[model samples]
Target chain A: MKKDRHFYWRLFSSTFTLSAFTFGGGYVIVPLMQKRFVKELKWIEEDEMLDLVAIGQSAPGPIAINTSILVGYRMAGIPGALLTVTGTVLPPLIVITIISYFYIAFRDNHLVKALFKGMQAGVAAVIVDVVIEMAARIIRNRRLLAIIVMALSFIAAVLLKINIVIILLFCGILGAYTTLRSKHDARSSPDSGKDESCAEGSGTGGSAGKKEGSD
Target chain B: MIYLQLFWSFFLVGLFSFGGGYASLPLIQEQVLKINSWLTPAEFMDILTISQMTPGPIAINASTFVGTKVAGLPGAVIATAGCVTPSCIIVLTLAVLYYRFKGLDMVQGIIKGLRPAVVALIASAGYSILLTVLFDSDDYTFRLSDLDFIAAGLFAVSLFLLRKFKLNPIYAMLAAGIVGMVIYGFLPSF
Candidate 1:
């Protein structure tokens, strides 16, 4: 019973390094993981990377953490996912343990204060940069819809203090609707010379965006 | 007892976090602010700033910082472990079942629905944090004078240089920090 565990090892190694070295939290991890796992290693393809990001963002947990889980599971199995997540999480855990011992001693140091103050500005910049990258992807697909949803939600949260969960649900519904409708339109077109009209929205087979790479 | 509480609570957060850690911000905030009383809301923001400066998950950082604050080094260890243990458990379990569900229609349908919601959550997180940044302070006053306009002008220039021109964010951040310190030193109350 031989198993190909190299994929798992690679994922674990990459995710672990990513977790350890990442600065400014989860936002920084996404693109780094993308560059390493997708471009450097070629373990996952480009479109798949996009989809992976979408799912990782849409679900719960840390991006690197959940990504390791999903990608690990895909590559090997439950054990693989476990290994990958641990590999990623363990380094930071250890580093933080060490930092905890010494943070108090240097807590009031001028350089440390300056570093943190700089990071406050950098952290926001990083978040915005990542958001722009993601928004670029969505905008490429459906510019108007993406802008509308983004602007509307931005306004709602900024002005009305709407809940995040509620905003997410609304966007998810709208995205699905548009995606499904586009698929339906594609199928119903006379290009294939098929006269079939999608009668039931739920059971119709034209769900074009269901592909792993597309999601 | 505190360890157990942290473990159970974060385990639940891990299970329900469907889109990633940002989605769990509100939940984590509730636990830390309302239920646990480990850190005041203001303190939590400070921890956030610290966490962003360092490596690792925000939740994990929060856990460690709060735990240390509350119960020392031991508490930090417990909290950090508690924060991550759930994903370890869940991700491992799901890895086994990945193939069976990979091509499923229902799963895709559900995910198709989940995507936009995730976007909304991200946007909302940004917004929620913005409110906290802008309005949560005691002296939350805005003056529309020329000096203020100069600060705004600098902010815009920085935003564009960092965003459009692709200047390094770390540099931009450091520059802003320097500008902040300088402005404070000079104007004091401008």
Candidate 2:
């Protein structure tokens, strides 16, 4: 009983501290998470760290929150997920609440205005940087389909101004179709691919918390 | 009354805010500025600045700021809860089910498709933020004369620093603010 309580407390406090102190959003928090969980605590493996980041980024909402939940769930379960997520969001809720009270004062301040306008330009640049980095990673895969989808999606978003939700749905369907077709072709090939079912089975099953780059 | 609205609005923001928190800004702008008039354009910009300055994700920061502005302490709680709930639910469900279906070719394909789309969404989001900084919209039209060249130059310099020197974004943002203060606040440039 005592161990369980201690574990939960540690989980909450570590996540809370990480979220509270980290600046620059999700990307920044990721490395900190690696340090705390993989290095300091030894709770998760290095590769699992990457998987958590991948799943977190791919899912909805904030990557920080998603990662916290995943890490928590990986360690414990639903309760851990709840605890970590609460810890992750608490600092921002507190900080922004205080700022809201001072909103009028800050709004009318000349220095703050100039600072924010300048920061906005910097923020624009950061977003551009994010785009370049993400594109470069995708390009490394050398998948023509991925590249084509990325370009088309960019056009639809930037030029045509299509709705974002619709675009995601369309791409998801296309991806599933292409992948499924390719898998079918491989299975039907005369080579028949020995150990295919073994590979598929091992891929699906949880490996005693030792999952490492199944993809 | 307002609390419920805040929750519902942020709930929608959470649900559709894929890619990242930055991608959620348009949804936020639409709900808070256009649909409800909870904040004016200038106030919206302030929220954006605060969101960036703060530690959490922009979505959480924005929701908290807007909620507090709209209702108060309880408003902040409800709004943040709403914004975060969808993610929690979605992630928890996936955490349970994803590995179970991990080997399904269709599943991998769906994720593969979503990856490029997410990249596009992120790029589009950056473009939107850049649009606000680079161009001045007056009477619903962009004017070349209204373009702020100084801000554009700062943006280029910041991007260069980030890519070339691998500078942390916080420092880049701070440097840009300092430059802005020097030019707009002290230099007496029009």
Candidate 3:
């Protein structure tokens, strides 16, 4: 699908505004993204937002940038992705640079120190909220296999202190193996209405090949 | 030379920081604190607080902050670019191909499997920060005096406001900062 004449500008400006106001982190920016992309622009559906976030979370680097790239690519391909990522990253770079110039001057100030101490607590609390919100969503699926994978991953990540890349790699392989076996079994039976794989939401561009194996 | 170091340091941070910003903290600490000696542990905590108040991903905010301190505006630019380059490359490629292969059951399954792990990683990240802020040492030891009651109280109040009232965290952070000034900045005699 062809994009509008000012697609790049729209992509850049939208992401720029969103990133400029996004405090906390990825979860905080997501709802704003839904409003802008799903509601206002009609770029993608609500469920598709979740998929984009999931893809972002699974990928390396910050979820905010990853989501921008995904949404941008969906709207206008690679250039769109590049533009959005640049826009999303710009606010932090500019603001933090300004802050750093004064960091030394203020580092030893009593008021500043106290304020940061308090903010540390606040930041930690917000992180707790993020953890709870994410956990609740993941658990809602109620798939035993999924839960098991999560638990093992937790052990590997938090307990054993294994590298995150290793955990993700293993889980990716396991997911692929488990789902491939299930798909083989389902092929012999009558097709069901619920096709998890086909649940990916559509957008104006990058339709990819439609799922063709199952009727 | 320092610019290259800044670029390489943040580049690794961006590459390995999977899940989200918070989950990337340990990696950031390793690079900034352990390897580079750019910031001390206490200074790192301060910057982390600043990161939250600032508008951006924690990892990006951190890279910019450290980059500026280490070098200057150019350092900030290079570090920020380093931090984002991995995402740009990886996500752009994935976005191009994902929808094409998204129909495969395995792709869906992998996402499903990764969901819980992401939660776990996030939780662990949060828990570690919570411990550091609330307690004196991060040794997993429980001690009364070791606990910073003021910080702990602020954490409790902030968590309550965020989860129960669904308050925007920015306000809570601002409020807590004010309270911190009152308690730590002014009430030293008490």
Candidate 4:
């Protein structure tokens, strides 16, 4: 019983400290979590960590939170999941709350305004880089369907100004349909070469490309 | 009532915010700026900036910040909870199924389909932010004379550094802010 309590404490603190210190968001925190749990603690295997990250990415919502839930659950079940989530969230909740209180004061400062103006430009550039890299990956995969969906979605968003949720729903349904159809086709034509009807399941899509060429 | 609205808005953001941090920008924009006028365009940009600069996920930071702005500490708590609730539930369910089946072809297919669309959403969001920074307006219409060349130059240079040097985005943002302070704050550019 005592050992179990100590383990829970360690789990919470590790996640809490990681969440508190990591500044680059989900992409940054995820690897750190792997190092701590897989490398440092030796609690989870390297392959298992990779699988957790894949599951985390595939699920909706922030990758950090999703990852935390999975890791915590794997380690200790529902209580551990609850504890790790609270630990993961508390840092940002506290930090942002403090900042929000002083935000009005900061907002009116001339120097602060100029600084934010500069950051806005940088933020824009980063976003553009993300779009380009992500789009490039899809294009490089040589999947016609993926490329067409990407182009159409971009046009829909920029020109037509369609609601984003609707676009996501349409693409998801289309993806599932293509996969199901392709599977069916492959079953009937047993001698057929690898089916290319569905986009390759490069589960590391969009934001997951962060560490691609950086090394 | 306002608290409830904030929860629901962020809940939708959590639900549909696929891909990752930047992809959530449009969903949050839809909620905070379009459906509800809780924040003006400038305020929205500032919140995003703060979110990017801080730790944790941008989605959580933005939700907490917006919640506080709209209501108070309670609002922040509620908004943060709403943002994370979907993640916990969905991930837990997925974890269970994953251990059982070991193969999630259907989920994989859906994610494959969502990938390009998520990229498009991020692009659209970036375009809007670019418009606001360069043209000082979010609308489609802007005069050439109204363009901010300095910000555009910063954007180009930042993009080059990020792509070529693989500079950390936090450092890039900080450098840009320092340059902003030098030119806009101290220099006689006004």
Q: Each model's TM-score?
A: 0.65, 0.85, 0.81, 0.91
For residues A48-162, write the lDDT of model 3, one tens digit per residue: 6776776777677888888988888766667777888889999888888878878788878878888888888887788788788877777797878777777787777567878
Worst 10 residues of 1 chain A by lDDT: A197-206
The runs of at least 3 residues in candidate 3 whose Cα sits more than 4 Å from the true structure, single-residue gaps closed, are A1-11, A28-58, A71-77, A136-159, A191-215, B1-5, B34-37, B98-105, B138-144, B187-190
Expressed as tens digits, the lDDT of each residue in A1-215 for candidate 2 is 23378878999999999999976576789889999998998787776577667677767788898899999888777878989999999999999899889876675567767777788788778778978998999999999989999999989877786767788789888987887787778778875565476545544444534343221
| Top TM-score hit | 4
Ranking by DockQ: 3, 2, 4, 1
CAPRI verdict on model 3? Answer: medium
Write candidate 1's Cα lDDT for B1-190 as tens digits: 8778877666655544555645566556656765677775455655666665567877777777777777777777677667767666654443333322332233344455554444554554444443343333212233333123333333455567877888875577667667655553454342
Quote the positional error of residue B24 for candidate 4 in Å.
0.9
Highest lDDT scorer: 4
Candidate 4 local Cα displacement, residue A205, angstroms:
24
Instruction: Give the backbone clash total of model 1.
Output: 13
- Pairwise TM-score winner, candidates 1 and 4: 4
- How does chain A of candidate 2 score by TM-score against the true chain A? 0.79
- The DockQ-based CAPRI class assigned to model 2 is medium
Name the better of 3 and 4 by TM-score.
4
Clashing pairs in 3: none
